[model samples]
Target: MADPLALTPKSSYAELPLRIVSAILIAPPAVAAIWLGTPYIEMVVLAAVFMMAVEWARLVGHDRNPWLIGAMTAGAPQPVIGYFFGGFDIAAILTAILFLAMLVMAKIAKLPRGLWLAAGIPVIVLPAISLLFIRNDPMGVQTALWLVAVIAATDIGAYFSGRTIGGPKLAPRISPKKTWAGLIGGMLSAALVGTATILLIGEGDIPLIAVVSAIMAVVAQMGDLSESAVKRHFGVKDSGAIIPGHGGLFDRLDGFITSLPTIALATALSGASVLQWH
Candidate 1:
């Protein structure tokens, strides 16, 4: 059996330049995510989430029900969307209701029967909901930028770190490509990004932001691993070959799903500078 982490062109070096190019392409939207304000950012993010849900459903062997994916992505992001159109309470309640209703539907749906449906609901909601906390914060836009920076750092750091170090596997069962060295490399990368942002970026709570970024890095990797587990269970590789180098939107956003919720919760609980309370 060939090593999964043998630095293949298709999976490794080939992706380096593409990833750099992708970063260059992505920077504008990411900047806009903050400069453009919460509503527009939320809208784009929700749209991406909707698309990912549809792709994820197909990848998970649920070819019979495309509408379920539609319902999930549409309904899940409704709460976040509601915040822009209505208010936070309304948006949260609507999404919660939709989730509850979906829970019942998932239980009742006798076809294929699995926990993923239930899991998917929260996975969709958490990141969207996290945005609310982010939007409400005084440093919301900066916070959003920092959050994105942390995840990006992890991705970039892990790639180089893993490639350079190349040691033991992290979780070979779920993600054969991941290595322990890579995990550490990713975390350290996030830490460096966090520290740099804190020292250089003229925004956010330095210590708090660094801590949050570090935590998010781990969570992001966990999210990636979780998504990998889901894909493995379904015997699929890449949610979809949508991006030239990247797999799919779901594959791209997997880390964000985990990191966003953690950032939201931390911001809410810590009374961090990220949030402005009256």
Candidate 2:
């Protein structure tokens, strides 16, 4: 999420060095895990979930309460999800339980923004659950890879387009850096990459997948914007300082929080992998 693409009107050459170094260090391992699938993917999901929970609690609660940490830890549902990662039903049930547990923990911690503190449980956790569930699906590898590609393309497209075009802001108040040109660039990029992914995999409804990819690109941007709104509301600059140039795990994955859950739910209701969406 934190990239040189949107730091200023044009691509920030000054920040390019750090961004490149960070991407080199982080992206390879992540791409490999998604490519590998199974236990490796689960490890990625769990690590991200835990980090996001901690960051989210701190951002909203603005406190260092040990109880909040405990709630964030419990809200992650590690062993429960770790052992049952293969089962979507187990994840769903665990999600509900964890949601309630976080709410209660929020009350117990007596954080000033208790309700916002509780909201992070689901927001930070659902994508992790979705990734786990989707990775265990019949077309797990292909589906997972396509989702990644589409999202990556969206980010790349938005970054380059927004900087290059330097158009009017998409939502001046929510995220002044974002532009309409960037959104369209992201949608177009998602459509092409998503359809190309289906072509490469030799499966799925290409036209529909293209359309969905474009829509999900919008969803991803919306997710990013929502996160911006949240940050603005809280008067925070970055979510946390975990990743070198990426601010935090939450900052890195703010978009996925929305897009992953949307696709997972759609894929689930369709009773098929995205490859079989037709």
Candidate 3:
């Protein structure tokens, strides 16, 4: 094991109050959409999906392929919109269009054929599917809020815990700064927050919320690590510095991307209609 002491430290969490303030300012409008159920949540999520798609393109050296990237950004939100308003029909059209464009671009760029599929599909599918999942529930806003809380709590807790305790690396190869102490601390904090949030809402199924949030915390971490692995593979930092301290949309939402699917799956299995909660 390499000495943690020897590792080059990056920016401390305290040094980024501006980034924190910016995130706080940015979150409320999106939260209000779900809280108010304005049908604009889909639009907001779509824009985020578009931003992430563009970031993915840049990550893969498609920065110059503005047209291709634009098509992808536009295509990603269609499936989510289709989930509620158009079902699969419009989504299919959008996917087909994006795929055709990818094929043309791949041939022209002479890039590895698999790169297009690997990068494009996730950018298009994940957020769109997440939107669909959110739409299935009546409390989509609250659910979305809960998801955000889970990811944020995990991140914030892990950051503080890691800083305070500062022990063994969780995955030194993928994320040099992440520590086992931080991971455990983060999970505990997420569970506490989940439990508290459920209680505050006075929900009937507190156990369900706690269990799901705990599980989602693990899943969210897995998602974060997965993105870190991607960045590590490419030898880059932050995926793009679009959100000031937050890196890119992908960086900010990576945890939600993975956990949203898990929530959707659980909701389906339980035959629970979301948005109907007390």
When summed lDDT is taken over every stretch of 10 residues in candidate 2, the lowest stretch is: 2-11
Model 3 misplacement above 4 A: 1-12, 15-19, 88-105, 113-118, 273-278
- Candidate 1 total steric clashes: 0
- C-alpha lDDT (0 to 100) for residue 270 of candidate 2: 84
Which rank order by lDDT, best down to worst? 2, 1, 3
RMSD of each: 4.0, 2.5, 4.3
* Pairs of colliding residues, candidate 1: none
Q: Rate the local accuracy (lDDT) of all candidates.
A: 0.69, 0.74, 0.66
lDDT of 3 by residue, 161-202 (tens): 776777778888877877887777677777877787777766
| Per-prediction TM-score | 0.84, 0.89, 0.83
Candidate closest to the true structure, highest lDDT: 2
Which is the better candidate, 1 or 2, if ranked by lDDT? 2
Q: Write the per-residue lDDT of candidate 2 for residues 108-149, one digit (tens) a residue.
A: 766477778767777876787787677777887678778878
Worst ten in a row by lDDT for model 3: 1-10
Q: In angstroms, how far off is 110's CA in candidate 3?
A: 2.1
